[model samples]
Target: MTVFVLVSGLFTGPHVWQETAARLTAAGCEVRAVPLGGLGRIDGLDGLDGLDGLDGLDGKVSDPGAVTDLESHISDVVAVIDSVGGARGEEIVLVGHDYGIHPVLGAADRRARSVARIVYLDSGMPQDGVPALAAVPDQLLREQVMLLAAEAGKGAAAELPPPSREEWRLWGSVAGVPDEALDRLTALAEPQPLGTLLQPLRLTGAVTSVPFAGVLCTGSGSSIALVQARVDFGEPAFQALADPRVTFFELSTGHWPMLSSPAELVRTLLDAAAGRGHRLTPANAAGPPAHLRPFPLDVPEAPVERIGRVDLHLPSGDRPRPAVVLVHGGPVPAEARPTPREWPILTGYARYAAGRGMVGVTLDHRLHDVTDYGRAAADVVDAVERVRADPRVDADRIALWFFSGSGPLTASWLAAPPSWLRCLAANYPIMAPLPAWGRLGSAFHPAEAIAHAGDLPVVLVRAGLEVAEIAATVEEFLDAAKEHGANIEVVDVPDGHHTFETVDPTDATREAVRRAVRTVLGHLTA
Candidate 1:
């Protein structure tokens, strides 16, 4: 039984961790909800002014604002650890959310041997030798934070106060939250000690030895991608985003998953506690439809006639590895692509392939027009040719993995294959055109193409829970391919939806998807 320490971010107290803590406690784990210095307490605020609007403490204002500092919070956490027996006490999992990470790290640095794991929940990891405020590249947001702190206090001990319901919603943490959690957050939130953010973290590199896991809120964007983008834009605070030790996972919710999706958050924390972190795969990039997580690709994107681009993902090795060209699904909703590169679900397979010691290439082709199958097919060919030209790719061993709508695009290539082409993989593919989607030309017939496919091997995966129309189409394609004497393999995934693996919400579905991925990769590389 592991002991769990739950810490909340600025302006929030243990109340914010109520749901998570309760769930953990019920799961037979010892739970401690720690409210850092000055939080959930009225004594520290007695010296600060500007509290007339804060739950009626007009006369309880304090001056000098120096009551709480970073050391105070560190002491608070260390005390909790010691009370439970410190390093010799119990197996402890320290979990921090948002700004709470500062003290969490401070405590971990102090009690490194005592902590079994540290989970960063939608927060930045403190870099050594840098003040938290100094790491903020956005001058305007930094200024706003400081100004809020000043407005809540007197002298140099200024602190930040609770945001209004509207302000909190604007911060993107209120989305998908229940009324109960939302109200509690707005009413119980206390002003935070600013010194925690102003102080530079002290480290002897001891905390690096402790296991670290990051639970990212994908409704906003991927923490890894965001950090990498910041690193590219020259932000030092986010340098640890690429740190190999911090295993990353995604929760398709707002930043406050504890309030928005408490059960899922509980499960994720338990996984981290048990030293079962999310694998560093592209699947960590999965999220809500409009906002999928972004990952750093190994190779640059190749522009394809303003329609889309091709992204290359490479495995680590000295010898050239076989390449897998990945084609993502059909046209996503327009609102989903606020940016051109934000298309959903292509990068995961690339990352998975790379994880399996192979080069993965994912491309974005124009599928916005229902009638533009020709252009989409051409894009696949172009992506393949370009990948085959890469020096690091085994030119003679390139394969293809077509997903969903892009599955049918393999028809042209399958009809008359190149000698170097090894095999083909399709997942929940759309082999025949539906009347609702578009009209198919004579050349797009799966049976006709399979008869001419010769000895080229193909692997088809069917999802059990898929809609009737798609299920029938895949079934018909399988029968036709077999009738044409095409060498083919079919893997059926029960209880899996069309995009079950990518937009995963259950363990069973995710496992099924993983099995399909393994089967596809195995057959393709065979």
Candidate 2:
């Protein structure tokens, strides 16, 4: 019989894995659902003031955060393996979900001789030196998480509180589970210590020898979002999933498959533990392709300067087609690697344009800060000229599509777009510079550029849950453009969040994106 050890994510205890554990045990497997210290049933230090986060625990005692760092969790797992009689070569299978992957990987590294395989269940994989928080692509979101942790624990320690019921519904969990499962999950959930997340897993690259498996929940928005972010940022976290030694499978459910699809989850887990699962490929892990034969742009510009290239996605054609350039959101992170510009959201839109019989162009530009605005505009102009130069492209018909922070940079094109350019479109754009946002202090308003944008045709896509300042500025621009008699179209996504097309995509949001693209392409052809 196989010995299976399971670890849970943030704010969750071993109880979260009860159903799955029971099923595994019924299958004649020995299971140990190990709970991390400070997260479950820790004894002794309970009555200490400011330790209210540990209110429900009823076990032995120790200094919680002080003693329960990364090494402590590793010790807990190693202890379990020792108790279970795990032996070299016939080592046990270790499974981790969500944030639990960190400590699990650490334990596997230390006890490599006693572990046969490591399973990452829709969890973010750890990079050798990049800590969990730093591994997250979105810096703003990272800051917000830390702030919430500090507030929840009354500055006593860095620990995240369980999500409120409403947050669960909006973010992901509610869509995957029955009412009872959700009730139990939330009830048993506890605040996860910050040290686990803050401490970087130190790996010596020797862990690659252990077999690995990943379970991707295709239906979960959070899973899709994390995978997309990792692929785009070229984080090693995504690369780990693609490692040759790793075998992966997909489940059509949400994040908590243990509760949502326990039976199927168990089957996949067993197959993985036995080294009998399918090999995951890029095609299987990612969304469907946008084009059958998209070509990489590698044109050279003045002074042998190879203009930053983009992927040229061609529509079915015996003749030339109109084109649309897709610009993604940014202040791109400084750590982002030099990679191909094929982010799903960008290519997703490009694919939509191809479906509508228009050639699509997705640009690659390096953006480090506010100063990159001028270079961004220049890149757009160069991209247009390069695409126009293509024999398959109609030089006289072109358009631009912008998302998030990149939207404001379109002001230059709108101000003086080429004769071949038809219009520009934006989605939940950060058009006006808010110096108060602090990245670029008070000296970076592009109001004059925006004022000049009134001369061009434009499509504005709005997501309902925007900050007040962004909404107000976008509305102001729309009002002014209307007064200037600019031809404009508006698409409203009332129930959508910013980046809803990826973060928490809905049928409605997808359609809204398509409508915006169609509207822009229609202007170009007209």
Candidate 3:
């Protein structure tokens, strides 16, 4: 007797959930796909004819020019909930997809007593005071979208028009979607009210008491493993995701799961409501956290000097020596204990470089999330500038080595490497963001930037057992590097994982590390 209420994302309406709702009805579940206000009225589905009882929903806004904001949409969802006995003690499983989640949360906040569970379908956990525009995957496009919305809102009825067919990729991944479905999606897509994206979602903190579920769409870029990795980094926000009340399920489809895999989405929804989805393990549940694990290599420690936020491991010599800047990877939690520069693996490599008569440098950067790549890159630039100016380091023959998630930082250097830059290296790096990151354009894609790396010696230490998404990015970079004839060398660790130095400590991994170090040093000394 559980009633399920569905809410669709931006530029979409209840019609988008028609196929999924039909399947859910066949499964003996009562389904109500709430047609949100401000998304315009659905006339009819051309290819999908004879679907009865679709038009003339109670709260749908018929006039496209009517002024509507987030409150109107929230009220629309609340109306549907109250209609279906939600206000009369009936338990309801409320589901929200993409921008639809905003209104769903707002409504759930008001009707917390009746909501059995709140489901986040392929969307970020929207926080209080943060608008939906802030959830746009690409950082650069987020700014532009907000700026355009602000400028357009001065008119009578401010609305941001839906993206064209070709422009849909900018909003979310369109993979696995059929041509007809895309056509329907574009045709029925409505102009979203600016208030929906610009106005912040206000919550009364009542919904936190309700159970939650997450339906992650892997084809669009997020997965259980990635979420776990972020949680392992001790991000306070992500820690809440590991709560036992929050369940998770992954769908191997695009952003619009209801369109690409309706039956599968329906099945997963049933499973989620039953609390049968995967439960994330708390950080340090098995043993000590990955960062605190011992280093794989036993290199002799070198004299270390801390200057501001940068650490310099100097070799035994007064003469100026070639330097190697080790840039650590992250979207690491800002409050992670010991910090990235202090991690044993980073320090191990820094000392190893110092033992080989080079000044090894490491610095903490503010790469707190995927969107902070711009800030992290600037911090790296500043650190490198300071290292080059050091009297104890050779300014003309410096090397830059990146690790893990910091891989995308190589784009700027590869596109226009300085004459004094000797070599570039990356160890198990993420060359590109996952598809779920939306079209980041070309700003952070090293796979595309490698085309411009003319004659710069590049060393890549690849992990054979790396995560599938990360491994795919490496292959993409390699292919692009080959096509452009860039000077690149590969040092493969066949049995190693992404953070192989500590996670998969073996002789093979240690040797791979040594080989990569030797290659970079050769270029620095050449």
Candidate 4:
């Protein structure tokens, strides 16, 4: 029989796994739900078959005054593993959810020979020397959490309180959870020991030999396809995920799968233990990277000169000419080869602008993640300044064109357009951060900033078949711009997808790109 050991995440105890454990037990699996030290009381655990005599239960720990850190949790899990599986001499499947994965991995590292498989359930692939706090998805909430931890550290008991019911969204998605379950989750919540979150997870590299499985909760904004997309970017870290030993399964529920879908969770866990899950396709299995694919339009190449981090595609003339600075969207993998400036689509646009008697500029920015938006915005400012100062460019007449994920960077420029700035354009851009990004503040929300665009000409090339999340943002932005009567033009490509220039190179897409370019050029040369 395979011994299954389960660990719960932040502000939660083994009691949260009661229903799932019962179902697993019925499936003839020997299950043990660990009660982490200092994570607070485990209530409603009475009559639960697998949780009897667990440590730190019934609202008390062996030593209430003792400080609990990550090591303590790891030790607790290891003790459970030894007592339950060691004596029985059975193969073990270690399962971890959310922040609980840290201790699960630490214990697995120590007892690699005993652990047959490790399953990551709706959690990130954490790296060595990184704290669990870094896994928090929201930037603003992460800062707030750090500040709270620092303040709590000065107290007699260094711990942070559980988030209230209303604040659950800050931690993760609550899509499939019932209202009563949410209330129970809040009521039984414990003050988390700060060390579990703040302390770095140390690994001895022994765990690398262990086979792994991932349980992605699609309703919580994670899926196998999304993981594959990151891997497609040629990132070394994500590339390692394509190993045959790593399998993946998807649960169509929220973050708390144990509560939202106990039966399905139990079935998936069993399949994962059997190593019968989906495998990611090897990166580059499909021709080339998306950015490297051919551009929609067929345009002549232009003379180009590299200057610092920016590339200037000069129009054929010594006299000053109107310019367009093309900005590429990313939290692109910093390790992606060839960078964005050299991508076919970006270069095609730059060369097309140059062929039309305009100076087109392409640049590499550090918008490597949602958190790096401030740095990326600064990079754009520097690139624009450099472009304006060029003797071959018209300083007073310039346009800025943004692509894909770089849409939010336009917020500041739209909110307060400079006198010399003539036009702004975006191609199937993410006008607002997705809900999974949490509240990133208004500065990155272009829909909110559209009202302040005043008389500045705004050209939008919208993809009809764009990803649902991104398309929603475009609609929201259009509504706000229209409400404020902002000077905006929409170039619609009915059959196009996001990054349509490469993915769907239909005539409509090609014409939309040309029309958008013409409108921006009209504004720049007016």
Clash list (residue pairs), candidate 3: 220-436
Candidate 2 lDDT, 447-477, residue by residue in tens: 3354565456788899887644467667877
Comparison by TM-score, 1 against 4, better one = 4
Q: State how far residue 485 of model 3 sits from its true place (Å).
A: 1.1
- Per-candidate TM equals 0.48, 0.59, 0.93, 0.90
Q: How accurate is candidate 2 locally (lDDT)?
A: 0.67
Each model's C-alpha lDDT? Answer: 0.67, 0.67, 0.85, 0.85
What number of clashing residue pairs does each candidate have, in the order they appear? 5, 3, 1, 1
Residue-level lDDT tens digits of model 4 in 1-526: 7778889999998888878877877888887778889774655656765566543243445378787888899898788778765666677899999988999999999989889999999887888899888888788767766887777767655777889999887777777889998998898888888888888999999888899999988666567866886888888889878889999998877788898998899999999999889988777786776678998888898889888779999889799998999999987989887889999889999999999999999999998877788899999999999999999999999999999989999999999999989999999998987645666677888988888899999999998887665787899999999999999999999998778898888888788888888899999988
lDDT of 1 by residue, 73-185 (tens): 77777777776774445788888887777778888999998888899987766777666665333344467777867765665436665678766643444557888778767
For model 1, the superposed segments whose C-alpha errors exceed 4 Å read 42-66, 86-89, 134-139, 147-157, 170-172, 223-245, 281-526
Ranked candidates, highest TM-score first? 3, 4, 2, 1
| Ten-residue stretch with the least lDDT total in model 2 | 296-305
Better of 2 and 3 by lDDT: 3
Which segments of model 3 are wrong by more than 4 Å? 46-51, 54-59, 62-66, 86-90, 439-443
